[model samples]
Target: MATPSARASCPLLLLPSPPPACPSILATKRTQRRRRILSCRAAVRFDRRDVLAGLTGVAAGELGAHPGLAAAEDASVVSCPRGETVTDKLLACQEAGQKPCPPTPAATAAAVDFTPPTSPMRVRQPAHLADAETVKKYRQALAAMRALPDSDPRSFASQAAIHQAYCDGHYRYGGPAAASKDDAPFDVHFSWIFAPWHRMYIYFYERILGGLIGDDAFALPYWNWDAPAGMAMPAIFKDAGSPLYDANRDPAHLGAYVNLDILNTGDTVIPFDPQAVQNNQVVQNNLCTLYVQMMRNKKAQDFLGDKFCAEYPSTVSSGTSGSLESMAHTSVHIWAGDPGSSTVGNDGQEHTGADMGFLGTAGRDPVFYSHHANVDRLWHLWATKLGRSNFDDPEWLDTSFVFYDEKPQLVRVRVRDVLDAAALRYSYDDREPLRWMDARPTPLLPKGTAAATTRRSLLRGAAPAPAFPLTLTPGQSVEVPSVPMPPRAQKTPAAGGGTQPDTVLVFDRIEFEPGRSGKFDVVINVPPEQAAAAGPRYSEYAGSFATLPRGGNRSGETAVVALVLPLDEVLADIGVGDEDGAVNVVIVPRTQGIKIIRPPRIEIRER
Candidate 1:
């Protein structure tokens, strides 16, 4: 997917819209949520920097005739190369026309409200910790699904195809990439839909497995990648002869520790050595990464992703990926996919990525389900342990998707129906997030340039910022020194009258060429002397984000890429949690070929 000789003249610029002033009088929880969402959608800044778009017309996909949100016909949630391109290599099945991609069963077609399973709650255990009997049952269930004919809806192949059709295969002819069957192609990734959709996907899959094994108590095991003990590829998934094994995973990673930050950094650039790299450091890094993804990303939108409030917003297409979906979840996929360091030459095909690495073939691997089980588990913990809330928007609540249950019946379910794990009759065996909560990165003393170090001499809000729309090269990094943290005790009252507001670091906007994957790592507050340590191993290493190659930017429109990172844990770990002065923004390029259209800024946002 090459860019045209010329690019779009008006590149999409996403400025942070301030959350509304907290109401003078307290509002109901639901009303407060609505106001927060409306305000987040109200980011129309018209400073001397650039003129913001206006509400000349309603943006597509928002509830019809909304009073607050505005959109121009030209506006888009994502901006791609001038023409839509397919960056994802996983779509070869769809491209080669192996089988016609199925249109999404209409949410209106034979749709029934989801009924919570009457069975007792199935507690999902860690794949590595399961006993011999549990492993045997799990293996047997998968073999049963595999034994079924491809035509059977409950067959393993059919289960994999559901992911393929909805995510990678939606655009056969590629007109506008609408969610409806007539318009063609619907995607569940890169939006609020990611969590709920996957929850239902595995839920039904779990049900089918239980029916196969005659155990209603069966639960899907999660790949507890967040903890030290469960970091390696779960042993159950490594046996080549087992039904659980995936032949396409990286050979080098077979027995190595699962490095959560193994995407652009892992691509054969670092030598594969489980013994050398797997240490207390890697485990600590994994924990901090979880803390950042779960705690830092507190707001419903930031955690769940861009709101999928209504019918796919073909007009406001391309919602931003939530922190979890785009960060650890994605990195793990690449790590497990065939040959993280190399292209798909071994198979004599130049595919984009191997099984777990690419979205199209992710479901082909059994470990993928366990991986998502962890993701879903974290969502459960985020909501329960942190007491966070999902989006309360009606469209968010009503958005529906279709699936096949163990009964092999076509069933349609909505976002509202899948929000609760308890209601769905499932729970993680190990729900406590104890080991990693306190694993925030330790700060190393600064030994470099005064300008690059923490602003001891520089006055608050006085340091010069980097030039806007900067292009980053692989070897060269940019450090935006002396950025102010979101001030404590801000005007915006805490949600539900909580103790304090959350402060976050926002990397304003980054652009991507259509069909080409997007990549970057965010490291905050590290001194210049310790800059070399800007990775997941250190507390300053906030997160690494990747947007898998895709068919196109949302509706071939402009989509803003803003990376919001919470600072509560990082600031506290580095002993600056109580302070609000300037911290350095160090942008490290883990891989090559990325451009930051807008620079980094700090804001006081509630998680």
Candidate 2:
């Protein structure tokens, strides 16, 4: 039998060949702006079942009359927590003659009773590498949790309800208006709380599972989608008789290569041939995306997301999604979810997404936990492997939320407690390589343009950048003409020589159709003609903002959110000097119908 690391190592996943980048941006050909630049099909020839072995108890009979794990919630009893969401909603209530929600508790009220454990750590193995026994243990734990009645806090359904409540706030005043996740008990998605909140959510979940199965050492296996062999939905979760399976996923996507950067093209773009030479770009493209996201955005604000204290969840959020939440994290959610199926939402109307896609019901799927485990593991890697430190803000460090522990007692945990996973007595198996580390993609020059193209002439003679209220052309890459870049400010050396402030591409607001998931890339200084064809494994690529479509049948709704991309690294690589007066901002939409209804500006943020 092969070791865990040995099982993960495969010779076929490497790139065939690729090259070049410039200080002057280059882009690839874009015949169809709406079509995917490169959709990947990464396949492992071995039978995955041969890799996954198990022993398990018979799955308990289905509960709640629903065919699968609905873990449904009642819309009436949900309340929006105060001091945790946007101030706009509160003002609206005051204007409407309604009293505001109560004030948020101060930092003193936050839980400080907890301390890191002194016990040895339990390691979470990657899903594809774990032996059959480990997989079986995971299933048996879920089966035990699933058997409990919804009334029990530790029951599977109740756990889902807790996640939905904290995900965002939804409500009704007993009127004809429909309920939406516009406000929140706690808005965890776009804020700095994202990683820590999810870590606690899953920590309690794992503890309960361990308690149920009489094994304190039991740790959840991550989906490990970052690695090629583990890209598809894990085989264990697909079994019909297992507690892990959910019927709401895309049937066509079962056992297929994961699409790391999918457009709203639906199932139209998932390639069936993993060996096809054309599909190789996607595998490489996603790896580079990881590199760009983790390496490019070194600041706590860019990587962890904006500070989201007292903000509500609506189409327009005060804070923006961070590098981790918006890019591949969101893409995986939209990819794994079944958009084709319509199920009843809290509003009692039919809506899209189940299990993995939407925020409200994602926790109902067993795969959601495993998926988040990988996300948490990535955060761990970002801090430990990359040597990045979190924010020094007292608010972020002291932020706390409540959860039910394995002992069935409601416990409050602080963000400070979860920063060290080892202190919490758990760690991820680092044996599998971080393959994306090597994905420093070379740039592609625009067609008809020679490598000898004069950089100074293009930099100095470029047309003035187009102004705001610029209506973007649908299904086309929109390039704002060269905009002036403020020269770099002199740096005062900080202690230990930490990261300097970042140069960024900041958008004031991006208005788009709500309730639909989409993607658009921000390629700094890339020629518009080549932006689309120049896949992520290229130097011009900066980052992307992806949506995790909301539930509900509501259509014709629009959402306005802000976006930011780090440009210091890409510009420096292309040889764009700090003294360079301007840079081109290209908007490459991966899906049609997306519109940028506002202007974008370039600025520098000091952390």
Candidate 3:
């Protein structure tokens, strides 16, 4: 067993050529001397089963060439060295303030409490208005902040500068007295570098955000990416025709291309399989290569990008798929690598890189959570589509992590605790959400509508209306004439047809404005017969709002919502579930004269 330190350094040095076969007595003496060296650091533990297993795989001729060694094989023990070199390195890491080791195997065997305490509902100040004007103001503020000197620790850029300073400060790895063996070449076991490094880096950035926007009221808005339209670079990210903004590369290019290089080593340019958008293996390799490059180059932006525009998952998952796990996993996994290939720190001392282990580099990337957000959303969608909920896996919950606090205090985090998005205190809105696995439908809106919908509404408090209206204007109300239901299909034993109790919620359009939001009131008069069962249930809500021609679905036969709202309110609403866990709503957003965009439903279960 090679000690971790023995393997953390550069690859094995070129060995000297050995002399021709020596006299048996002399050879025996030399072997004994080498064995003494090996025994000091490592002890051989032999088991009959392993020796027998190896012998069985050998050919008769090969076995005959070394009959004595073979005869002793069943009872012979192979070298299992515990390179003291690793122990010495661990000591050095400790002296230099690296993360402390886990208390001992016995001490850690007990289960840890990873359950997150109930989260207090946050009464956050409303989002800062993001109209063109506000966006401009925010950008200006950011620029001013970035322009400050690094010594002015009051600014975020300054705080980040501190980390850069410390990278060459007391945190430096390896010392003069460090053993040569501990400075061996790199391999997979160096992933430990990523976890600690990123943890520190993100903390610095987060503090910067807290400093920029008052921490109490600020929340970073993600780019709604579930919709293809939102996937493009928003005007907000550009300096307007500046060479920095490549419209084609805005939404996916920066992160994807950089990550592709990290994991796949600047592999193919075009898609691996033209028919398949992102093949999994290609994605994995792409991420691995990208991280390795980052580690080798000592360039974090090489992977994370230099500007806020490139910050990830900050862009929302507005695409049709409604899932981002595969991409996220590729991102985290590559930051570390599969066991080890490249991507190790070059300190020639402490092991650093994903090669150190999965928890090393992968856990360090601030992108990990953003990546997991997509994974979590995918699971949510899977539950809805497959009629299931909750990923109740013991194995998942059992995964453990040791994170360093600001004081470098080691704290443990578990996978189960991360399952809830609210617990994480972040929310992502998916703009396109209509997904049925293989069905990639055309957008309900016409050409130019997607981009048009992205525009902020002139009316302050209402959902933007394209060519159709989903709500009434302020102080206006119109009665929606009730329509009779169509006759049901005749059920027969031969046809195997039976009624599927309707769990769908039908609504007129929902409306909202910045200050004055619209509300749709419905009288749920529960029937006496079903009242006993009308309690909380986990239900999937689905609905769609379409902007058809003026006369289309005029008979009131279509199940769509068309409402209007005043200019100063916010979009705030609640949903209820039905008996036996059944409820689904689909919403489409459109106004009479404007082209319409289909919106995905917001799923809710009675709380």
Candidate 4:
């Protein structure tokens, strides 16, 4: 079996010849914009499985026979006026434009020497808690980064490029031939790799920022969006004259408190009154979300996500995203970015753009690092406080990604090396234990406690009602009839002294239209008028359906996705399972700026 490094080194050899005539970089501005939009759309269409299997081994004989295809594939070898060589068609696309396109930076080079950090730095606190000195250091570092020319590797543009390369599949596999296969874009999201990948990304970014200010002890402050006091955009980052501030953000959200719920819609653009009553409610709900995502998800697959396999015969997944990444992580990204900003030409069409909204451009904003810092801190809490363990799979442990070091040299890092933050020489400032865990309402009977009746007296009950489908269109909602608990979930003494069975509400065969950014919130037992009140709070809220951008395939073939939510906690919170035995589910479309042409179908299953 070939090692990952060995396989990655020669991706071009495994691909087909490049296509003819790259899109001219010098094309009219209107044409360039159109091509960019089209290219991004096309890029999302190809499935990861097909990209890994079918595209890697196209027969060279077929290409050799077609002389034009062979020539086009070999065009990367043609030298440009500058001392740079075109590596592939994608590079050609980039080169054709007015800008100079350098070869994609590699993890290792013959001329560069790389070394990992040896000393450790104290972890920084949340932005609100950071003292004057720490804030000054952070601000100065960012200002210095802003001062650097775009050409420098440590500059903001190049750093953002590194992220885009991984997320958007800018780097081809094998060699020049790899350039022809534009469909095979490499993506780090929607997999077990999401947490670790982001951790590594922010670690280096923090290091670079520290280096810029000549403070090896400097640490990046987290946004701390989970707490009420820290919920608003950090004051330090909001100053217009500050280098950390971006003009592209939604002006309304500059100092507004963040709503952990209502994430699918661009909350930044929505009017926020910040009533004390609502603010307090959102804070409690945010804590519950954190508990559910971090502590309630016990299994590795539930928290860290499904495994990622990039080799042949191993199909890639949008993978089942863990609760944290899907909810809080995804929500924060949408919340921080401007929904109305027109960085990309979605004019007339409703959609958010610029730094935080889109995947490709997210890294450009300085807040992205702070946002990810909080995410990393949560991961740390899960591991240390919740006793969660990292995946032991070799594929996960051995997977390597390239990142630039403070030395500004590209270094190859493995997932295993980054599993511990202390080893990386940084730790977060000490904080108190989560108070939310204690705030949860006590269960009727302690879990695993036996009922008063014997096994013979406590008989299994009837089956639940037939599963029903609910369809939701853009800005529309539908409520399904209440679903009853399965007989197995009823309270009973264990046959062999086992723990009480846990019940779950499974949304099976959930399907969404391809190429749309529409999402829906799942609220349980909430009346139509009160649906708006349901969110990260307790029983009233369930979960959400936020599909990632389908890789450029707009074939309209919707993939069936399922959401498995634990019902016990929600039941306990609502104080209802014993009395009502059934709960109504409401599905509300979160579409505000974007349109979902095809309606989504959701089927509820009780287990």
Candidate 5:
């Protein structure tokens, strides 16, 4: 919708001639009529392509396959030349009872101002942000409520009431541009980015808690899944203050829905199963599409209510398990800006179109995080099943992200920072891991099947790993792909084991020439059955990374490092099955003259 300032100046800029006899009354009448007619037209045919035509005063027919005007052109009553003179024709027609062309602004500034522009950095406060007293009261109510049984459904029911009350107090109409503004429309959906958004959102809730409980000591806990004890649903999720709290969930229903077989499939175990990786990608894309639709929502009540959440009944879950694999509700995380080359586009280009800010549009409602915590929790669970040392993978050691700390300070966090319960500086003693309950006594299969398929499929197929193999040089990186692992049946490197366990595989190891810099990338492929098996057996080449010096950024000498050793036969000890599996490793370098960060262990599972 056009802003008031834009509308107010429309007469001055578009109507360059002196005002007509009934100009004031005519302006108001035209404004109302246009709103009644054009707003409806705008709703159906809106796209980025039409923004230029809307601003340039071009004929709507000349929109030239621009998606933005499709709906509007289809609905327009009088199809005429939409030029700079059109506005005058329109006004003249309103008075003369003959259809006239809509006039375009004589001055560029007026047309530019009235264009349906995107809000790059607009921040609209949710109603809950108001009322210092209500936030204070609610915090106190939450502390008292914490003492209630964590397992009891009533706990979440009560907390949900508090959430509902707060939501009721502060909510308002988000506006019409809610739809298609961002890649995500505002509705309930959950995924990895969910927890991050909620962490920020719940900070407000915690501040309210601090005020009411009279203790600034109150810190909301993340459902810790680094270990089994930290994996259960926390009291906060079940607490009565949570708008999303569900207390009356049936255990039998949960048992039927939350199958361990589907939940524990770690990406590492399968590495890069092409099909599984594709499927995961599909899920993410579908979600982004759905989220974009939700942003079109005009009413906050429909968003806050369960109506939107119920759309994906199969995905949403009541417990932590159900939430992770998929959410019956909407939880999303919107990365709302351009992130440069790191972004992968729908067209698979280096930089084709707007990709990042798609998530923060007005259409996306705020409940995206609660849904993602569940998905993130599931990822933690998958990591555990791989091995406690799974986090020790050199690939994860230096992974970094920017987030606001408790002191409201911006800081970079490594995955290692959250590895230990104490180091993470939080606890989730109340929520238990899936292991706390009975494990399936037999290999669980889908409905009506007694035995499962022995021909296991790939879980996460190999693309390349993200680690960069720095050259001995300090500031370079490149991609590395390890040579294919020989079949396990053939005797190679270290007697019984295919590759030496202690040797690290540099997927993207770069070789430097005399006084010069160079780089390359390695790729790895992991099979499905082996990924599910989870033991350190078969090894696939993962990807490699490398970088180079600023001035000497060019390809140089390269070599391969192959080591074979016996990995610790601790798979059975960690609840992993000893089975055949494969992983392909690759390395990619950003530039040259940089050292490639290498993996700590070597490969053995080869024929």
Candidate 6:
């Protein structure tokens, strides 16, 4: 792996060091006095429930008041492009005769003895393995959630809103942008925050479902799309009369068995014959993809993602996403949502997909939770079975997010508190050992002398090149000059004597317009025609950059995103040597009609 210096650098690295000594007494007094004044004002606004909460020995002061209150009521609110309050937006929708917005519940004191479930429940199994009784209970719980009024935080609408608030960039808190204007949207994807953020999200969501059904042991069943037996949409969720079923999903995908490998290419309708040789081969490919994403990716940055700090602009992502987040997480979402539908509604207003495809409406579908449950399971496996560790950066540990607890009370949680799944009182049911570990494909390599020549050539050409940031217009291609191999990679031996050293192409500081549904494909040293036609073969294709329709900077500022593509594998597949040379990189538009505003910079690194 590349050293810290070799890794892409960002301004966020200059985070505040240790603080200085104590300030003057007068300054301290002024600070304390200001706190007292604010405390008094907050106390005056508190409802009777706040007093009762304090009386229970859990001081209300310890729980910070709603962070959005001040911004929600500011005089500048009228100038806000969107409605000042969430309620105002809801009212506007109602006035316009659009779909009625879910109501927000009144704040109330949490139950005095309320606590999350502490006893362990047997880990949930793939939906296919669930018994009839278990399926019935799951269906009943979902029905209850749908029956709830929109106002209740545990209600299906409210639960989905929480996810939209975080992922769609609607939620704001006190930050650099908050004082003069609204803060940038808080997003959990495309950075180191992905794993831990989703873990906590599903944790509270599970608790809410259990509370509604009064089943503390209730566990979310996983969509085991990795296995051929569990490849079809679970029968429980497909029942037409069930609350778990959503009408907006792809009609053809309902009963069809999924081909996880072909999800990205929009060819998910593979015939469901378990005995077919082609079906078995696809299953093996899926397992191999899993092993590469989970086990082969050993570095923290390559697995969890890049470093994210408080200083990093909310509009821009500070790190590259891991393979799991990019491939497994994103592909499943696209496959599940209606593929032919445009994001723009008939009224010309943008709306989220009502199925698993779009980010804003993903949580609204009952199956999203179960899909994420399996994603969370993969993280657990990475930590336990693969021996991968979470990032130790203090900034990562200290960063926190707020969620509504089972009491429907907003609670703050930090990343440090959720490293263990058992602490949350749930686990997955035992499954067969990883069969992919023994069935991996053999490494491809050159002859012995040729391997040494490639390594020596790479080392001789290892001069650091100046960074280049290219702007790509639609149908335009830019070539990166002087791509260099890290010196450390030359000393590292290939899996086989002739195998290529692991290398990656890093796209840093990618910025573009928010809410645009465009994607750009990266091609390496190939003609435009070949690059455009590149399929799953590593030879001509690198990865593509996909953008979420929501979650752009509301202030109209650009948001930067990052991606990492395996370069050595691409080179090896094409019989190209990584000798110190200037390689041409072609950036082509994958989705036409959506223009590129600001393109990303590219660099190559040792993985």
Which digits, one per residue and each the tens of the lDDT, describe model 6 over residues 41-139? 000021233222212222324323322222222312111111011111111111122221222212112212223456556468888778777788788
Candidates' C-alpha lDDT: 0.57, 0.57, 0.24, 0.51, 0.24, 0.51
Residue 445 lDDT (model 3): 27
Model 6 TM: 0.68
Question: On a 0 to 100 scale, what is the lDDT of residue 306 in model 1?
Answer: 57
lDDT of 5: 0.24
Global local distance difference test of model 3: 0.24
Which digits, one per residue and each the tens of the lDDT, describe model 2 over residues 401-458?
Answer: 5556666655656676677777788988877678888888676654213212323434
lDDT of 6: 0.51
Candidate 3's displacement at residue 96, Å, is: 6.1
As a whole number from 0 to 100, the lDDT of residue 27 in candidate 2 is 19
lDDT of 3 at 404: 25
Give one digit per residue, the lDDT tens place, for model 5 in 516-576. Answer: 1122322222222232322111122121221111110112322221111122222112222
- Single out the weakest 10-residue window by summed lDDT for candidate 2: 7-16
lDDT of 3 by residue, 1-607 (tens): 1111110111000001111321110111111111101000001122223223322222323322221223234323222121111111121111222221222222223324334433332221112113454344445444544555533433433333222222211111232222222221111111212222232233323324434544422333333222222322233544543321212221223233223212211223332232442434443333332222221112111111111110011110000100021122333333323322323221222222332122223322222323333333433333333333232223223323332222222334543444444554433344444322322112222333322222211112222212223343212212111111111121112345532221112221222220111122211222122222211110110111111011101121122122111100001012221111111112221122221122111111110
TM-score of each: 0.74, 0.74, 0.29, 0.67, 0.26, 0.68
Best-first order by lDDT: 2, 1, 4, 6, 3, 5
| Residue range 1-607, candidate 1, lDDT tens digits | 1011101110000001111221111112221111101001212121211111111121222213211112221233332211222211111122222332332223124545567778988889988788787899999999998998776778888787666545553332222332232222235665666787787788888989999988998988889888777787888998889999878888877777677766544443333343553355566666766766776777765677754321233323434568768878877887788744333211122446568876667788999999999988877777777777666655456555556677766665666667777778888887434566665455554323322345443332234555656776655556776554434445267556863555666554565533445677766666444554677556566666576644422333223455666666666556553232446677776665466655565556532
State each candidate's clash count.
16, 13, 94, 18, 158, 1
